[model samples]
Structure formats: structure tokens, C-alpha cells
Target chain A: MTRTTYRWAALFLALPLAVYIAFVVFPLLSSFYYSLTDWNGFDVNYNFVGLANFEKMFSDRLFSNAIGNTLIWTVAAIIVPTGGGLALALVLHERGIFANIYKSMFYLPIALALAVIGQIWLWIYQPNWGLINATLRNIGLENLAQAWLAKPQFALLAVILAWSWQQTALSMVIFLAGLTAIPQELIEAAHIDGANYFQRVRRVIVPLLAPASVVVIALAVINSLKSFDVLYVMTRGGPFHSSDNLAMFMYNESFQKYNMGYGSAIAVVLFLITLAVIAVYFRQSAQVERLYD
Target chain B: MTKTIAHNDRRAATASLASDRAQSSRVPMIIFYVLLTIIVLMYSAPSIGVLLASLKSTAEIAEVGVWAIPRSFELTNYVEAWNGGNAGIYIRNSFFVTIPATIISISLGVLAGYTLSKLKFRGSNALFIFFVAGLFFPPQIALIPLFRLFNDLGLYDTLWSLILIHIAFGIPICTLILKNFFAAVPTAIREAAIIDGANEWQILTRLMLPLSLPALAVLTTLQFTWIWNDFLWPVILIRSDEMRTVMVGLASLKGQYSVAYGVQSAMAVYASIPTLLVFVFFQRYFIRGLTFGSVKG
Candidate 1:
């Protein structure tokens, strides 16, 4: 690149990079600094407290519960969306006419805001008038109906189900793309060998879909880590904070309780976990790309 | 004659076998449609149920199951939800936050993406990786600090805070998408333009920008949906009721109208309309944007 080209590049890149650094990088690094302090987000004078917040976090029951719930959420996010999406994609991949309609229906939830979906599910889970219990009672299964979002055992699961509904469409679309890329001759050869539908799917289709699965699973994990809005709107991580994930825990601690130092510590932990996940994702995806090549 | 007879028998056997395969496939085909219908219904029930609930009166919503249609369609529920109190204000605020945020982010992204992909300056690859890494940084990690930063800047409790934060966070994905898009544009075009004495600016504006309309459209739609549907930033940044975006407004609206299911549902439906329209109109581009970001990135 010539000097003039270099100058031009600098001019073009300067503003956006500056804004990004100011808002994104600077704040992120400062959060790391803040996590080591006793700053409560208010006073000017506070002593540096090293690892004290981390120690407190380890002993905190809510924090541990948040971690546990996050793990459950991540696992659920992977299995439910990937499994449901793969099934739907397989079924819809061969059915062209109705595939459009089905895809639209499945993807509709993704278009809705998390807050709106949270509200919708809140109403659906309403004990008396919500759809679930109402249907259960209408079918003479009143004994089975319970407050879906109110119970500790059910709250996290309920939130996960709603999240999975939104997520399945994403996985399905990715899988559909993957399924499309699979060679038709291979499936035909399997059929010529008299492999039944189940055998074909299990042996041929699912194995070929491993790359897509890697992408879907990575996205699901990252998404589960950031799960907050729905839990905030639906249960507020309530019924004794059973559904509070790391994000919500961070929010409540930092903003609601003004524990800036502790919140920053939690944020750092979440960020590291996210970074690790993304690292694995990139590594696996690189291998997948190599295989394709 | 015997050889001909053997060939005919073999043909009949293969024909029978083909027919049997077809016959067996019919059953699974039936089961496939049945399963597809069930899944579709399950997926669409929430949206449909909410829409139906939005059309019912509060009394009807309470007295009957959401599955039941109202005795009369209360279209006024939408009007009430919009014009009644702060829903209209919230909707307007969302537009205020979304449109400008989308435009600014896309513009900055295009410039940076072009420079990185086409210009090939020193450290450009490193810079691109830096931006890409931003994608993995969970927003929650930055919340408290950004909250404090915005407060220090006196941008808190205002739409600018939300807009700026959205633009900042939106840069990573937008730049990634556009960088890839610009890279795919034939370098020969750039070479020809350079030979014609066209500078980087003219080439980008005249040649690249025009060619990148499809990519720009995808980025715009995706970013619009993202900023429009955002809840976390606005809830934390904009404390004033009038300044609140629709998502936060809808949350508070739920609190106030907890018993008014029809009205709340109407607001929820209203909040979803813009993105839903984008989805309906640009489903292909939207899905492409989504899959491209994940699958390729």
C-alpha cells in the first residue's frame, strides 16, 4: 500500500475505531479495573480490594445458584434446539411446498422481541386463564396443571422452553442449509442399499450434519450465557431467585443493589467463560471448514 | 425365446419392487405431514394466541380460554393500547432509537469494512480481529461500566445513550458482514477504477456501495430488528417513562395493566409489528444474515 493509500486507510478507519475503543474496549478494560476495587459506583474515595469480591462470589449462594442454573440452561439450550431443529429441518427439507410455510411459522418467534415473547409466555403460563392450564383443565387433567412460572422447580424449565422455542428456528435454518449442501448421490446410494428412513437419517444424514451442529451448539451456549431479558420479564429470576442466571445476577447486583465492584467481578467471569466458548467454536469451525475444503 | 422370457420376468420383478418402495413411502409421507402440522401449530401457537387475545375484551379474555374466540372483536384494544397512555410515545421513541442507530452503525461499518478489506493497511488484520472479538463480549459484562460511563457523560436517561450503545455494540457484526461482502467484490473493478484516477472515496461510493446494496439491505434489516427489539440497554439507560423504548415501555405496561390482558397483548403485538414486517418482507435476507454470521464467523 502506498503512503497516500495508507493515509486514506487511516482516515477511514480512525473514527469508527475510536468510537469502538471508547465505548467498547475502554469500558471493558475499566470493568476489569473496577472489579479489583471497592468502588460502589458513587464515592470518589475507595480502597483497592483485591480478590475480596471474588471470594465473596464463591461463597454467595445466589451466585452459585446462578451458575448452576446457567449450566442447566446451557445444556437445555443445546439439546432442545439442536434436536428439535434437526428433526424439523429433516422433515421440512424434502417437503418444498409446505416448507416455506413451516419455516416462516418456526422463524416467526425469532422475529418477536424477547420481552414480547416473555410476556406472551407469562400469560400462557398463567395458572387460571393461561393457555397451558386452561387446556389441561379443558381436557379433564386439572390435577396436572400448575403455575408454570411460579414454582422453583418449574421456573427455570419454563423459561428455557420459551427460549428454546425462539432458538429452534435458528438451528433449523442452519441445519437446512447444511442439509442442502449434502450430496444427493450419497442419500440415493443409501436408499439403493435398502437403508430405511431411520437408518438413513441416523447413519448418513446426522453424521453429515455435525458441522452445522457445532455452529448451533456454540451459538446456543453463548446465548444461554447471556440469558437475561426473558427471565427478567417473566419471573424476575424469582420464586427465590431459582432462575437467575449469570447475566441477571450481574444486573441485580450492579444496578439494583449498587454493588459495582462485585458485579464487575461477575462480569469478568462471564466474559472469560464466553471467550473460552468462542475459542472452542472457532477451533471446531476451522476444522469443519477444512473438511469441507 | 427362453432368454427373452427371463429378461421380461426380471423387468416385472424390478417394476414390482419399485412399486413397493413407492407404496411404503406413502405411509411415511402421511406421517411426515401430520408431524409437520403438529410442530407448526406448536411453534405458531404463542403468536396466534397473543394476536387472538389482543382482539378480545378483557372480560372475554378472563372468562374464556385464550383458545376461544371473543364474542365480538374489540379492535379498539389496539387503539387503546396505542393512544391510551405511553404506548404511542414508546413506539415513537423506538423509531427514534432504531432508525438513527441502524443508519449510523451501517455507515461506520461500511467505511471500516471497506478500509479493512480493500485498503490493506498495516495491522488491518489485527484490527479486524479486534473488532471480531467484540462479538463474544457479552453485553452484561459492559453494562455497569457503560452505565457509569454514560452517566459520567451525562447521556444517561436519554435516547442518545441507547442509540450510541446500540451503534457501538452493532459495529462488530455489521463490519464482519460488510467486510466479507466487500472482499467478494471483484478486485478488478477497484483496479479499473484506480486506473481511471478514481480515489478510494469515489470508488467506494460509486462502485462498491452500489454493488453492495444487497448486503447493505441485509445488514439494515438485521440491525433494525436487533435495535428495535432490544430491551436491556433501554431498561438500564433510559429511566424516564417518555424516553423509554417500546420494549421497556411494554415491560412497564405489563406492570400497570397486569389485569388488562387484552390491552397488554395488543401492546405486545404492536411492539412486534415492525420487525415482523421486516421478517415477512425480507425473510430470505434475514435468514441469510443470521446463518452467515454464525456459520462463517
Candidate 2:
């Protein structure tokens, strides 16, 4: 490239690059530094604690519970949404007026903020007058009614259900796009070969949808790992911290408790987990792309 | 003669079977529609409940379930929700943060995305990858340090803190989308513009940008929705009640008015309207932005 071209490019890139480095990169590096020290966020005379924070995390029950809950959240978040979305996509992929309306209705939750969704679910899970319990009573199945978000056993599951509701819309949309991309001739050929509806789906549709599934699964996994807003809004990892995930644990520890070093350690761990997931996702997606090629 | 008769009989049997199959398919089709209706109702229950509850008095909400239509519409719930508390200020704060953040991020994203796509300087690929990698970094990692950094910079309790954070976080996806978008514009257009004595600035502003209107719309809507719906940054950065975004305000409203489900529901409805409007009006672009970002990346 010529010198003027070079100068123009530099000018174009200067502001974004500077802002990115300042806000994103600088904080990331600072988190790494803070993770190893005993800084209380305000005190400058804090000691270098080395790996003590990381070591302490292993012995901390709350940290362990957070890890476990995070895993549960991630697994459920992936499976429920992917499976439900795929089913919805299959059912709704056909063109019709009703199908279009159903698509919009299913996608309605996507537009609402997570905080709002959480609050809505929170009210829905209220014990006395909430929708679930009231519906249970109206149906004469009052025995099934329980405090969905208050009980330790049910809180995490309740939050996951809400997350699933919001997440499935995006998954459905992606899978619908994937389904649309499939050539009509393939399905027609399958039908001409005497393949039934289930047979056609199994042979032609599902296999071809692997790429969309990869994208959905990757997004679901990453989103679950970073799950915070809904949980924070609904239960705040309440009823004995049973619903707390790693993100909540980090936030509570760092911001709430002001344990800067420990929170940074938790942040580092969460980052590593996310990085690992992204790496796996990239590798899997690359393979999927190769298959298409 | 017997062979001809047999062939005619087989044809008749096949026609009968085809008719049977067609008739039988109608049953499943009916079942499918029924199932779809149930699913739609189930999916829409919460939103419907919230909307209805927002229109009901507190006593009505308590007396009857959210499923029941209010005997009298309490339109005052919305008025009260708006004027009663900090909900108005919080929503205004969200707009203050969302609008400028959207404009700034999209502007920078266009410039940077255009440069990275067309300029092809050394390390451009690496820089692109760097920005894309930002997508994977969980915001929790940045929270504590960003808090301290903003505090040190005296932006801790201000709306600018959330604005800057949103812009910084928004760059990756915005730039990625814009880069892909600009790349799709054929090189011939740029070459012709250059031959016609247009500079890079003029080419981008006058020639390329108009062509990229769809992508720009997608980016603006997506970024606006994201920044508007953002919860974490506002919770961390803005301490004052007046500076809080809608999500943060709604969350706090949940605690403050735990007993008054009517007002809380009203606030929920109020908070959802802007993003909901975007979704309704720009539904195609919204879905396109989502699928494009995920599938292409």
C-alpha cells in the first residue's frame, strides 16, 4: 500500500483501537494483576498474596457450589433450548399464516430484557397468587404447587426454565434459517423415494442442520456460562446460595463484599472456562465448515 | 386378458390407497395445529399475564389470578408507574446511554470495519481476530477492573461510564458485522470511485455507506437493543437512582415494591416497550442481525 493509504488507514483505526485497548484490554490485564494480590480495591498498600486467592477458591464451599451450579446451568441451558428450538423450527418452518404468527409469538420473549423477563418469572413463581400455583389450583392439582424460586431444590431449575424461554427464540430463528437454506429438491427426492415425514426429517433435515446446531449450542453454552442477569433478578442466588453460579459468585465477592483479589481470581477462572469453550467451539465449527466445503 | 385385468385392479388399489393417505394426513395436520396453538399460548402466557396485570388494580391481582381479565381496566397503573417513581428517569437514562452509544459505536465500527476490510495493512488480520475474540470475553472479567478504572477516572457514578463500557463492548460484533458487510460490496465500486477522483473518505461516506444501509440498520437496531437492555454495567457503574438504566431500575423496583405486583408489572411493561417496538418494527432486521452474527462468525 502507498504511504497516503497507510496514513489514512492509521487514522481510521486510531480511535477504535485506542478505546478498545483502554476499556477492554487494559481492564483484562488489570484483572490478571489484581487476581494475584490482596488488594481491597481501594488500598494501595495491599500485599502480594500470590496464589492464595486461587487456592482459597478450592476450599470455599460457596465457590464450589457456584461451580457446580454453573455446570448444571450450562448443561440444562444448552440441552433444553437446542432440543426445544429444533423441534419448534421443524414444526414452524412450513409457510403459512398461522405458522408466521406462531413464530412471532415464540420469539416475543427475545425482545424483552433479561431483567424484565426475570421479574416476570419471579412474579409467576410467587407462591400465593403466581400463575403457576394459581393454575395448579384451578386445575385441581394444588399438590403440585410449590415456591418455585424460594426453595433451594427448585430455584436453579426455575431460573434455567426462564433462561430457556428467552434463549429458545434465538435458537429457533437460527435453526429456521438453517432449515430454509436446505434445498427443496432434496426433500422432494426423499419423498419420491417413499420417505415419510419423520424419515425425511431424519435423513435430510437433521443432518443438514448440523451447522446451525453448532452455532446454537456454542452460543447457548457461552451464554449459560455468563448467566447472571436473570439469576440476579429472580433469586440473586438465594435460598442458601443454591442458585449462585460462578459469575454471581464473582460479582458478590468482588463488588458486594469488596474482596477484589478473590473476585478477580474468580473472574480469571470464569474467563479461562469461557476461553476453553470458545476454543472448542471454534474447532468444532471449523470441522463443520470443512464438511460443507 | 388376465394380465390386463390384474394391472387394472392394481391401479385401482393404488388410487384408493392415495385417497386414504390424503384423508389420514388431515388428522395429523389438525393435531399439529392444535399442538402449535397450545405451545403458542404457553409461550405467550407470561407476557399476556404481565400486560393484563399491569392493567389491573392491586386488589384485583390479589383477588383473582393474572389469568383473569380485570373487571375494570386500571389504566392509571401505567400513569402511576411512569410518574410515581424513578421509572421515568431510569428510562430516560437508558435512552441517554443507548442513543449515543449506538451512534458512536456504529460510527467507529464502520470506520474500523471499513479500514480492516479494505485497507489490508500489516497485522490487520490479527487486529480483526483480536476484536472478534472480544466477543468471547465474559463481561465479569472486566467488571471489577472497569469499575476501579472508571472510579479512578472519576466516571464511576456517571452515565458516561455505562456509555463508554457499552461502546467498548459493542465494537467487536459491530465491527465484525460491518466488516463482513463492507467486504460484500464489490471492489469495482471502490475502484470506480477512486478513478472518479474520490478519496477514501468520500468513497465510504458517499458511495459505500448508502450501499451498506441494510447492514447499518441491522447494526443500529441490534446495538440499540443491546445497550438499552444492558443491566450489569449500569448496576455496577451508576450508583445514583436517577442515573440507573431501565433494567437496573426495574430490578430495584422489584425489591422496593415486592408487595405491589401491579406497579411492578406496569414498570415491566413500560421497560419492555422500546425494545419491543424495535422487535416489532424491525423484526426481519433483528433476526437477520442475530443469525448473521452467529452463523457467519
Candidate 3:
């Protein structure tokens, strides 16, 4: 009976496992192999590069810029959305008149495709005739008006801020759920103990909300690192390639430039960097121990 | 004695009802409303812009903010987008890829999640850990190899190729979610089913599966929204115009690189309608799903 059941379980698992290995595992391993060789994607003949691709990568200014942009986006993305979401969640968790409406509304932006969000932001950031500059002029802050996306200094920051608005909704939902799980009795107890609102939030609520924060922050970092659509649509790494992230760089190098070996090398670097970051996060936070336990 | 018991029940009900009313009128109520309104406006800005833009003509959009009410409301953009822009075909391709991928991921996810959660098996922990690690590896890292592999297999530029790729990457998160849900199911129920001589498959299909409807509903709605809005995979995998999903179609429609704001905005609205409709219909399920996983803490 036990043997039969084990066989049944194996049967259930086999197909997905096989498919995953074929598409996911094998491709990744092969990519790593190709990263060491000098193979143009469309080329008929190629030779082993022996880390020459990687050696060239160290001096590549554009590659470094992409990495910097990715890190900046990751940090800013996590901080802004997580912070904003916490405030929204706290307000809504108090059970106001339009609590449900607020949640549904905040969630609206997330439902639209990234393509749409990118296009909308593009219109908003138009240099002269755009909504933003027009609004600034109308508000008597004429000096504040500038070319938002066209200017190299503000372009990536503008894009990141736009991305944050949509993401905060998800983070808010997570935090709201976290808030609800805290027993009302405990909050009342804290109040009775003379804890002010800010104190209560800091000492009691935030600690209780740690798990949700972990999930939201981890996801935010990963998503920001992987963000491609908005960057691709709005700027295509324009303004002298100031807005490019690792993913965009990978795509541009591989498909646009036809440098398969170099692209694979960059990808391998990204893959390793992501792994290292996650490992460091886990190690520093000791989050995994608490999360699984 | 019966009168005393009935009298106590009446008193208890009234007391509970009064407390519920008291909680509603708490001091936090006013602050909640104002904050919610502000946050909601911020969230809906982009979608609202798209809707208004889609209703205006190209010429009007260039002249005014997308949020402006058109002097003459022109809903013709929607018509043009659907018929002339081939949005109909793009939307069709989206559904074709999405439905099959959703079905495969959910079914496989539920099975794998249940097995990992309830059943004892060798290599289970290692496999689970392996998948969890896979979650953090950016898909871009595998793009070149996957593309080449798909090309070699003659699966490039097809919806099946895209669906298969979606399912592969989707498995980890889906399985993780379902496992979390399945673990919440009571052990006693499984013990009872086992006592009845039900096989593993029978117990899964007839007993556990039926009880998991809420979680499955949540998964379905979430999967539909996610798979529907996906852009990167489709852009990378499918090159044919007819094979392009709605997101990619709208993306490529950007006229002369950056000047198609009017038509692109129109296409954005068109692409959003289906998912927005799904969102409106399944708002409760979607909310419950997003919150449910968090609430278990």
C-alpha cells in the first residue's frame, strides 16, 4: 500500500518537474556555458572566449551605470512604497466610512498593464506642453517646471517615482492584513499603558507587522531589479543611456546588438549579483529562520 | 429555567450589538475617511488618465491634458483601436495564452502544494528549497538561452512556447501560495478520510479539493490578472504581430518611438478593459486573496 501511494505521488510530480527542468534548469546551465564562449547569436562559428567577455565587462561604463540604476531603483522603490503603504494601511485599518472603497481605488492602478502606466507617465512628463509643467504654471510655481523625462538628471528618478505609485497599493494591502491580525485587545492594552499613537505604532504595531514587511520589502527589491517595461517603453534607456537597468541592458546587448556571448556574461553577472544580495539579506536579517519557523 | 436561559441570550445579543455600534463611532473614523480619499486618488490617477485619453481624438490630446473633458466627446478611438489596430486579435491571443497557462499552473500547483504540505516524501524539502531559490533568479538571466532553446525546438513565435514558459516560472509562487493554504486545512479531516480507505488521489480530489474552493477562487482571479497583464515574456517569446499579446501589441504601437501618445493611450485603455472588467467582477476574491495570505500570520 505504501509503495503504491509513493508511486502515485511520483506520477503526480513527474510532469511538472520534467517540464521545469527542460525549460528552466537546462537553459540556465547552458547559458552559463555560453557565457564563457564568444558566440554571436546568429553566427555559424565561434571560439571559447575564456573570460574575455567578463574581462571586458569590468571596464564597461554603461554596464556599471545599469547596475547603479538597478540598486538606486531597488532602494528607493522599497522605501517609498513600503512607507506610503504603511500609512495608508494604518488609516484604512481603523475602519473609516470608505475603507473598502479606498482599498479598491488604490488597487486600481495595479490592474492596468505596465504598458499603459508607461504611456500615461510619458504624457505627464512631456517637457513643455505636458500636464505636469502646465499644472506647475497654473499653481504659480513656474520655476518648478522642467523637462521631467528629457533631462538626464531627473529621468530615472521620475520613472522610479511613477513606478512606486502603482506598487504602493500592493504593499498597502499586505500591511492592512498585517494590521488586522493584531488583536484589538493588545492595542487597547498598549493605550491603557500610556503609549501614545506614535509610540504604540513604533513599539507594538511595527514589530507585529515585521513579517509583512519582510515579504513586501523582498518582493519590492526583486521586482525593481527585474523592471523592464516602463524603462523600455518610456525612454528605451535614452537620455544618453542613463535609464538602463540590468534587464534592459541584457536585452539590448543580446537581441539589438547580436552579442550573445557578451549578453550571456552580463546575465550571469546579474544572476550572481541577485543571488548574493538575497543571501546577504537573509544573513543580515536572519529572516529565513524566523520566517520558516 | 427555560425562561432564564432565553432572557440571558437576549441580554447578551443586545450587549454585543451595542458594542459593534460603539466601535463604528470611534474617534478614528473621521481621519480614516480623509486619508483613504487621498490615497485612492493617487492610485487611480493613471487609469483615469487612460480612460479619458481613450475617449479623445489624437488632435485634442496633443492640445490638452489627458484628464480634460473633450469639447466633443469622441469614443471613436475605442472603435479604431478594436477594429483598425487589431486589438481584437491581440486580446484574443492574450486569452488563448492566459487560460491554458492558468489552468496548468493552478492544477499542478495545488497538487504539488498539497503533497509537500501533508504527505511525507523523500527529497521534498530539497525540491522545495530549490524552487524557492529559483524565485529570486531574474528571468532576464535566462532570456538568451531560453530564446535559443525555443528557436532550436521550433517553438519560437508561438503562443504555446509563451504559455509553457509562463507555466514554468509561475510554478514556484503558485505552489507556495497553495501550500500555505493547504497547510491551514485540519489534520483530523485527513485522518478521517484515510480511515475510510480513501486513496491519496481520492482524498485529494473528493475531500481536500472540495474544501479548497475559496483558495482556488483567489488563485484563479490573481492568476487571471497577472497572466493577462504580463508583458515581458510575450515581448521576448512571440515575435509575430498576430501572435503578440495585448500588452506587447500596445507597446510596439508607440509611433515613431515616442510620439504615439494618442494612439498608444487609446491602445492602453483597450488593453486595460478586459483586466479591469475581471478586477471589477472579482474584486472581493482579489481582495480576499491578497489579504488572506497575509492574514495567516
Question: lDDT of each prediction vs. the true structure?
Answer: 0.87, 0.88, 0.80
Question: Per-residue lDDT for A5-80 in model 3, tens only?
Answer: 7887787678767777787777877778889888888676888989999998889999899889988898897799
Lowest lDDT block of 10, candidate 1 chain A: A184-193
Off by over 4 Å in 2: B1-24, B293-297
Best by DockQ: 1
Flag the better candidate by TM-score, 1 or 3. Answer: 1
Pairing residues by index, what is the TM-score of model 2?
0.95
What DockQ results for candidate 2?
A: 0.63
Clashing pairs in 3: none
The reply for model 3, stretches above 4 Å from the true place, is A284-293, B1-39, B187-197, B256-262, B291-296
Q: For residues A1-293, what per-residue lDDT tens digits would candidate 1 score against the true structure? A: 89989988998998889889988988888889889987787777777999999999878999999999988998898899999989888878867677777778888888999999899899789898788998899899999999988899999999999888888888998898888878876876687688888999999988887788898898888888987889889998889998899999888888889889999999999988888888888898889788866
Candidate 2 clashing pairs, residues 3+ apart or interchain: none
Pairs with backbone N, CA or C atoms under 3 Å apart (clashes), candidate 1: none
User: How do the residues B1-297 of candidate 3 rate in per-residue lDDT, one tens digit apiece?
Assistant: 999997777667557755865797566656655655765765676677777777788778778756786778787777777777888999899999889988898888877788777775888877766655667878888888898888888999999888998788777777777777788899798889888988889988998899889888888888888888888888788888999999998887765325645566777877888888878998878877766545544
TM-scores for every predicted model? 0.95, 0.95, 0.90
**Which window of ten consecutive residues has the lowest lDDT sum in model 2 chain A?**
A184-193
Query: Model 2, residue A98: displacement in angstroms?
Result: 1.2
Better of 1 and 3 by DockQ: 1
What lDDT is reached at residue B295 by model 3?
Answer: 50
Q: Distance (Å) between predicted and true CA of A14, model 1?
A: 0.6
